[model samples]
Target: MGKILITPRGYAKYGDEAGKRLEELGYELNVNRSGLPLSREQFVESAKEATGIIVGVDECDEALLKQCKDLKAIVKFGVGVDNIDLDAAKALDISVGRCVGTNSNAVAEYTIGLMFAASRHIVAAGCDVRSGGWKKPTGVELYGKTVGIIGFGNIGKHVARIANGIGMKVLVYDVFDIKQEDLDTYNAKSTNVEDIIVNSDFITLHVPLNDETKNMISTKEFRQMKKSACVINAARGGVVDEKALYEALKNGDIFASASDVFTSEPPERTDWVNELIAMDNFILTPHIGSRSEESEINTVNKATDIMIELLENHD
Candidate 1:
């Protein structure tokens, strides 16, 4: 039996039953154990004999795909497929499947959590408390604040619904047109990106990463935002420029910012990420927007099922 390569660090740990099911199907599993995403060399070595792969953030570019003659299918463990070279996979007749909306609610909830955390200075307050200092920092209320959501997709829609439930006015910005009925359902108003940038009290990004969206929020956009505005990005890394974000925070161009993704995962300590990490107003998370127990299990199991189905069909 050919092998299946599983590259997600949290796969079996979060979805152990699914892993056992795959093993019972007689496919040899090559699980990644390094805790970090596999390097190109490591991926090539591990996947050369694999008929299917369920990947996390590993790069599966054209060059890598060309070398994997045995690979028949690739399943994205989460919503984003930017890491995989779709054109190369299609050219090679390899099936690609992604678990869409598997983590939408989880990411939405996390985005809202970031909003409250940043607005209330929760992290700073906790730190002060730990140091035996007593102080009540003034914080903005989410109620009646304007929340701008970029990308009216599954995650964005959820965020809007939650924001509305909390009495926040929702403004949505997306390139594609959204139906008025849908907008009315959430009490959201469709607006342009420029309007959202300048008018929103809390701006949250939910767009995918692509040529059009890379650095979508940079120096110019930051400059347009109000000084009291807070920006939250739980979307893909590189969507918000880390360097620009650092400068904006340092210079008080904006009130504060929170990011769950960065240009580099587990970012190196020497870069602009290091400087951003030291800022009191800047909050960062280790891309755990979709790490909720329910989301993790759903994504892993769904990816596993897709890989198994594709592998079986390829035979």
Candidate 2:
């Protein structure tokens, strides 16, 4: 029987049935007990004897992959695999799988929520009411606004759908070309990133974190946006430079901004992050883009299936 290590904090709770299935298939399940993402040392220690792993955000670099000689398969519970070292995994002959599209709807909905929260000052307004203040801040409407969607992948497509339903014009910027029929379906137009950055009323990022995409939106991009525009990043962190974002927000280069992911998880209370958090127009969420109950179940099942197949079929 092969041993499978599961390192995602939510897997044990949301993946109990999947765990049972793996056990029934004769695999020993070693789940992470930390209730948080495993550090590099913890991950290496936990994964040493396992033939497979269901990972989340934990760094699986070349050094760690080489150390875990028994590790044959890695199943990513979420879409982004930036934390996993793919080149190293391939070199080490370990199979890597990701549960793509499993959390699309969940993340897409959250992106819309962030947009509304920023545009309407929803968080600030709620705080005011709770604090015995009665200030009704003027806010912008989504209807008829131009929404720029960066990277029209699974999550981006769903975001476009919701934006269209809200009567917003959607401009899509992606590296790959989207079909005209598909664009027409959502009443969207294929445009360059520059156009989206300059012309959008609300800009939402959905790109992955990679060398090309890292710091994709910095001071220059922020400068291009209209002063009334609001930016939403429910995608990966590091895509937008936090320091540049701080400067932009502080100077009112853009009206407001919201981010669900950051360059670092449980971001340190650095001066830049603290300053950004202190701004009323800046909204931050602790990377809950795929935290919905439904999304969790779907991702867990998908990840489990992939792990089982890879391990069972390994020669």
**Which candidate wins on lDDT?**
2
User: TM-score of every model?
Assistant: 0.94, 0.97
| lDDT tens digits, residue span 1-315, model 1 | 678899998795776788787889888888887767778788988878888889988899998888888899999999899999999999998899999989999999999999999999999889889999988989899999999999999999999999989999999989899999989898999999999999999999999899999999999999999999999999999999889989999999999899899888888787676888978788989999999889988898888888888878874
The lDDT for every candidate, in the order shown, is 0.91, 0.91
The sequence of per-residue lDDT tens digits that candidate 2 reaches over residues 114-141 is 9999999999999889999989999999
Q: Pick the candidate with the highest TM-score.
A: 2
Clashes of each: 0, 0
